[model samples]
Target chain A: MNKPASLVVLDLAILIDMYGDDSADTICPALSRFRSEASKYINQLQHAVVQQDHAEIARLTHSLKSMAGLIGACQLMEWSQLVEQAAKQRDQTMLANHLPELTTIWAALQTELASSLLLYGSADA
Target chain B: MTLTRNIHVLVVDDVILMCDFLYGVVNKVAGCRAIKALDGKAAAEYLGNERIDLLITDIEMKAPSGLELAQRVRSGMFSQTPYDIPIIIFSGNAYREVIEQSIAFDVNDFLVKPITSAGLTAKIQYHLQHKKVLKPMSHYAQLVADVDYAKAIELPTEDRAFSVAIVRELPEPKADDVDQREAASKAKEKKEKKEFLVWPEHATTGYFQLDRRMRNFAFNVSCFHNVFVENCKPVAIESERKRACEAADYLFHISKNIKQKDNRRDFWLLFQQRLDKLQPHVKELNSINIKHHSQVLVLLKRLAYWWMQTCSRPLIQINEVTHETADE
Candidate 1:
């Protein structure tokens, strides 16, 4: 996988700052875990959207938004918040329109996380 | 004040990643150990058995939410730990209702989520230094009732809106008034002191059996006091009261065997009398009713104080013996 010239999906400087110099060891495993959990939440979110389960959508998106924001996945976090708000307001039209865009950002985030994990020598990855 | 033992922080959230993240952040702090609980139930289990100095939890979770956990802790539902343990509730959204609920639950602090390490570190360190002052159980119960009532009654949007009308405006304080306020504040500060109910070190009598019985008596009395204050079930109150009475009776019996100086004998006699007074309350509690609860609580409080005084008697005697020897 080719690394982006400038990484946009995941900014890990916050994690570095939080964990200090030896953050690579910690960040790698967390990134791996995040990738796995975020995928599961995103998949559940898609199913919730298909079934028009507004409450489930809101819950999944809320969890995603929190997880994204914690790791500084700014784009994914913003999209998750928008989707969460739409779900809360029972806005099916908005949800239908934004679901694809949210998935795209999630895919990019996963790719970025995968590459970063490899860079950090994550054994699980 | 620096804690002598490692600070144990119980972090609870439904999200695994979030829980792990918090666990990592907590462990980064020196002398701090973090235990993660995936949900409120797990957290309660840890609280029951472990020595948790602090609690950081997410508000929204399946059954027994963070607010509910806080309620349980404040209500003395967890018998193994102090009810006034500091609780910090964190969530992604700090909605008005959530904030209101947190306040009603008497949470020590609330954090808007996406919590950074630095922010969490500051909160943990601050709470570690300062202990939470718990409000009365009735106060929390009333607050919860009010919150529930407010939620149940939803007025029309037009009627929901209201403006505060100030009936009067107070004048600013004069210079002398400011001086008086400052003096009063200092006087209040000087008056405040930490009360020790049972100082274990000083409470140790030379007789190991007596000391053990004294400790058991103190523990039972404390358990009863807590259960009564929280207004727990009658069965719980009865159980604690029974244990307390048995411990007190044993303590009083054993204390009769110890030989004391004439001056010290009076103190022991007084202690035994206090224990004797508690017997009627224990009997009354056998047919316990609401009316007797307050009276019983008051008597137990006094008994606990007297118990502490009696525990220090041995130390006092030791000091007197040293003084007499020095004079010789």
Candidate 2:
């Protein structure tokens, strides 16, 4: 009578029938591509900070904010907003404080991204 | 493997994040597709055209609410009967009585929000696997009729494999007249035996010998005795076939969390060990008509393999775990 929780998540097996393989193939790549692009954008933000390119940092963080939101990155989206604000004010102190939080966020993202991608691969395969 | 390939899954919640989080994980599983609904109204709409295999629903929706939806479905006014899909309630709520009552309403599983993939996948597979084994049990059950189910017992020494066959006598034909039909049906019910048998690994023979002295594999049928038992009944919980296959893979896991034997025992020792272990539970697991026969069947079958694989003995035989007749 009692069952585990995972069954709730896997009840989504109908897509393969309705959309065919192309729609089916999109799930894993989309998740992997999302995480990969996010990582690359974060890398650019790190480079912009090193070069003291404030404009590029602000621009990159803005897009990163949306991408993080779209991907369900909880805290990463929250703190990236602050990083974006610091860039607008040209405040070195705020930007410096955000680096440690950004690093923490990025590490957590990596951990979850790895797991998510791995799951998608198995499901898609 | 794709037992539920076309099964419709409904994901419901007030929060978009939770919905997407649930959808993202479930959408990847093969043989399943998900429908997204931000609220009760959205969910009800999806239920109109599509048939959902399972429901992963958050309880506290704004307008109609999850409880309200459950009540609506339970009413005869709307029919979800054709699919007979199971519903799982998801919530952060801590009301135990409310949840228990929901079980009275026949909700399949309860999952808290912020679900883990392991927990979620395990639960889904459990129900799915339970369902898979029940197919044979049900199909065979429909064919059974009342008869003296305790087939004649065979006690042979371990030297040569004893041929112990269970002759499941078919039920007598139904009588024509109304009075005869009523009487015959009643008589049929009284004599019916457990109409189902699941062979582990689909073994050609239920028992094989470890020693020549005594019958190493003694099978104690529910309807009869003087046979042997080896282990607990198979997991009778409903499940998808693919899920049971995956769960079977965990027999090798060293974790003590699972109860089945995954270790080895001596050849001679297996006889007495199996007798002592299996003799007592035959009657209990045979109480298949108990609550959940399918789950008990699965548990018993898996237990047979568990003992076979784990024991120093190479084979295990189990019979009469269930008694339903087809001859009525």
Candidate 3:
């Protein structure tokens, strides 16, 4: 897997760290939200990969890569690019090892995001 | 007057991310609400239903570029159609072609992009203030002896905001030739009408001295404001250097007289009351000035902390600017 550029797809890592969710606790909710969104896209990406749809995989991975940068998701930020590179080269071995770990981090991020959203939802409402 | 309450801002950009960023920033401004459009075509569709007070559209886009949108907007051929709307083209390029296009399309203004939140807000404030001045010129029709030129500037068909160009009072000659031999009344109108003559803000900085050379009083004040921005501070002026300096020099003389008589209290009182508000040069710069030392300002802490936080980052760095430009 080729190492991806830090900010090609998901930019604004700087801005999110600076400004996203100024009202939330540490702006981690934004980070969590990014993780959940990536999970949904990556889930679709897995389906595309199994069906040999490289184009869809590229598009989904590219978007998730960008989103990772936006939310400053460190591991996914690194891994999403590798996923994109593996998909590009049709390296199923590299893609398979990274997908489960990416999915796991993404799941943990969703639970955290949902909990944070619930907390803010009541507080803001 | 403008519906000085919430002026609806329509932010058009091709990038979804940029559009969302502007919407957040605009919504935070007092007396403003924002809607987003992903591209110029999306903007045209949104305009059909929305009565937007201002349009902040980006220049580069996938379809119906911002300039094309501005042209269609000026022509009144688009769908929530109003008579004339204020538009600011947000481009990375604010060069000759973009500026001339804005002028030909009758855009209220132009701003260069990659601007920070503060820079973006400044242009917004300027156009909005320009609209305010013109919109109320109607009620001052009494000043026009009730020959309402209100329609000349225009009232937005839906809301009452006036177009910025009409709001900016043009300095046309009062039917008098530039001769010392002009009739008494004609000469008097010239004295009162001096400031309207001005170098367009887009003019090259080189042409600035020409206004001073001509001794055009109102144009001089405009020049003074621009000069301060260019030179970085107020300059010491010579007595009777040019006709433009006449009104200001006379005031300076009066101020000197007050100083010689030990009237510091009265002089500063007059300064706050009658001077800077009317003077082209204003001392109160940047609701967000970082170079000065003051405790009352918000956002200073954030700026102060940026250096400490970003010191370890590989690609970014922050530093304080020692010199400051004057507010134009």
Highest TM-score: which candidate?
A: 1
Q: What's the C-alpha lDDT at position A32 in model 1? A: 81
The CAPRI quality class of candidate 3 comes to incorrect
**Which 10 successive residues of model 3 chain A have the least lDDT summed?**
A1-10
Q: Write the per-residue lDDT of candidate 3 for residues B1-328, one digit (tens) a residue.
A: 3336878898987545456567777787778899889878888887777777788898756557787676666656555756267787765322333455555456776654333455567668777777521233223223223344322322122122111110111233454564643665575555433322332222211112322322344345434333433344423211112333465455445544444544323213322222332233212222323233352122222221221111111110012111112222
**Interface RMSD, model 1, angstroms:** 21.0
What TM-score number comes out for model 3?
Answer: 0.36
User: Per-model i-RMS in Å?
Assistant: 21.0, 23.4, 17.0
lDDT of 2 at A70: 41
What's the number of clashes in each of the models?
0, 59, 6
| Model 1, residue B220: C-alpha shift (Å) | 66
lDDT of 2 by residue, B1-328 (tens): 4555566778887555446656765676666677889899988777655666677777755556675555445442244432335666765322333354344345566653334444565566566555421122233222222133112111122232212221111234556789998886676444332211222222321122111101122122221211112233333221222233333223213122221332211211222333333333443443443245455554444243223222211122233222222211
Measured against the native two-chain assembly using Cα atoms, what DockQ does each of the candidate structures obtain, in the order listed?
A: 0.12, 0.01, 0.02
Clashing pairs in 3: A9-A66, A10-A66, B47-B80, B48-B80, B195-B218, B215-B244
Top-DockQ structure, candidate number: 1
Candidate 1 residue-wise lDDT, A22-63, digit = tens: 467778877887888998998898788789888788789878
Q: Considering TM-score, which of the candidate structures 1 and 2 is the better prediction for this target?
A: 1
The stretch of ten residues in a row with the least summed lDDT in candidate 3 chain B is B309-318
lDDT by residue (tens digit), candidate 1, B141-208:
56545766556422112122111100101232354677797886675444322221342433333345
Which residues of candidate 2, in runs, are more than 4 Å off?
A1-125, B80-83, B131-328
**TM-score for chain B considered on its own, for each of the candidates:** 0.44, 0.38, 0.41
Q: lDDT score of model 3?
A: 0.48
